[model samples]
Target: MRLPTLASTVERRLLVNYRVDPPAISRLLPAALRPQLVAGYAVAGICLIRLGNVRPTWAPKAVGLRSENAAHRIAVEWDGPDGIQTGVYIPRRDTGSRLNTWAGGRIFPGEHHIADFQVHETGKELHVSYTTRDDATRVEIAATVDDDLHDSRLFSNLEQVSAFFRRGSAGYSATKTGHHLDGMRLDTRRWQVTACQAQRATSTFFENPDRFPPGAATFDCALLMRDIPARWHSLPAMPVETDVSGSVPSDARM
Candidate 1:
């Protein structure tokens, strides 16, 4: 049985975002979802996170598990029965924990691939890199905490960027079945973020030319969250509408 909620400590999270041409992002999303635009540009990114003390809400903290994870996501919105709803659509998930890979789609939300991760952190800086076991994905970033958003064309300031993401806490993940999306929501009581400057960043998923044509995507800004208490809740799955081909594109799977 799936747990109602899982509690965890957000040891670290880095959102390395990109601004992409709207049309390019549209092709990859299922028909039910449309890219959520900012300044007429679609937003996509890699979320590199490290979670500690993760366990069912009823369990003691001492039994919690820790893991390093990554997700490739796109900001999206869809027509809900109530109105327009906003969230993120995750195409792929990777983790260093075997337990996460085994329990993800079965007990939580998305299916996860096993990956190897290298991480180094200090008070002011962070460096992380990972590669999936199948060699289908790789990502790396070196960033430092900063006081202001740097060279971001999407949002005018750090506050605006932070608020934008806070509003899109719900995320849907693509499932192997392709007929529906697995959903989850992140809850944090003391929500806080700091602007970060990525001195170096790379993502094979975003950099693939076959998926994103030349000049379609560009680096934006990064945000960092550290030492936060959080909870994860599963949501009802949403049915998807696929194209007439009756199959999701291979490029959609990492």
Candidate 2:
């Protein structure tokens, strides 16, 4: 059957304000992490806090599955000296299922560290709680995910590169399959490196941007990291698993 489009029905609310100062950010991060920062703008960093309710028109029996009725989500974005980072916090129960096979085995494919999240709803507001690493820094994202934004096509191209990187297989290449954005191109490359860490999860790193056709600017280098919840393997066959602890698995290997 045809699944109803929750994309159009999803609603967003602004709960907390996000803030970041470029100078303050520069002073906070280590020198090795600076290259990931986006340049040409003084704004350098951003903070974002959003509260939104989503109602899916249908429901499935698997875990981590999005409900067809309604649910809530809070997402944050931040830019810092190391790189641009974003996190979305979704209360565990809001998701009807716990299996996230849609990740295509790229994430949450096995059992690992997962935690119960708590969210409280009062009138039109929802309260959420989460924790970050002690040494790890947190920055608020200033950018917003546009309601009408549809970049799945672009993301798909990026994912192709991400998949190859995850396997640690060499001699792969990415070419521009298509372009939905002006400055972005679909890239396929060879000799990509897959780096996986216990606490950092898995990522594919590309050393050269010139492998693909020339665009207005070269990406220089690119990396795709997969962020999957730890308890993925324990609860198999579910649509989604919500008990995310914001921590990568302890056993991830390169």
Candidate 3:
């Protein structure tokens, strides 16, 4: 299906970043896409967002939907016909709205799993938590609004990190066989992000010592944005070659 453009209010967004080993990042990326490195290490993270009043461009605002969604994303770039394309590669998507899971794969890219979410905001502080239906993924973020980055190895400062993600508005989702890149782009009039201090944060996926190893993955920085007008638009899937012979057929993967 052709991707559709969605309009909504980014009621809240928690961007928790992690710096991972280049090799670890490589294992997660699909064909053509490479981790957008900072300094030398690869970047990856969890994008937990609360979207409000979401609806199709042509639909009435009164009929919009709201949901809490999370994506495990990797900062990636690839060589395209035009030049180098920078964006994110999403491995999994979990949403509180069951409608999203139902429409996935048909109305849009297939979603990975459905999960319940809890969000609480107290002045400049916020806490968001969630777990998948099967309990495979569990995450939590307790943070306070701030203008300081406590720790980061990938970029020198917050601006450097923000600037990198600003140009990476485009994103692709991985398929089951890890061959196809389902495409999507984030549309925002402007990026207004603030630095955040993570009082405590955890993600089972990135915190796995065996997978990320010691020093391989560590907390870089956290950012928060609120009340931003944005849109989600579909893009053509990027086909990758599995070998030197030719492009891998779409249906052949899964």
lDDT of 2 by residue, 1-254 (tens): 12222211112222221122234323222221221222321111111112122223243223223311111111223353496533321111112123321321223221111222333433323333322222121211112222231232222344453442233211111111111100101122332322111111110111113211223222122221111211111111212111255322111110
**CA shift at 132, candidate 1, in angstroms?**
0.7
Model 1, 1-254: lDDT tens digits are: 34478999999999999999999999888788899999999999999999999999999999999999999999999999899999999989999999999998787888899999999999899999999999989999999999999789999999999999999899999888888888999999988999999999998888889889978999999999999999999989888776688887654544
What range of 10 consecutive residues in model 2 has the weakest lDDT sum?
Answer: 177-186
Candidate 1: TM-score?
Answer: 0.97
Q: Candidate order by TM-score, highest to lowest?
A: 1, 3, 2
TM-scores for all candidates: the values are: 0.97, 0.24, 0.91
lDDT of 2 at 79: 51
lDDT of each: 0.91, 0.21, 0.81
Output the worst ten-in-a-row residue range by lDDT, candidate 1.
Answer: 245-254
Per-residue CA lDDT of model 3 for 135-193, tens digit only, reads 87899999999876667767677787788888888878767655566788889997988
Candidates, ranked, lDDT: 1, 3, 2
Give me the runs in candidate 3 sitting further than 4 Å from their true place: 243-254
Top lDDT model: 1
For residue 131, model 3's alpha carbon misses the true position, in angstroms, by 0.7
User: Which of 1 and 3 is the better model by lDDT?
Assistant: 1
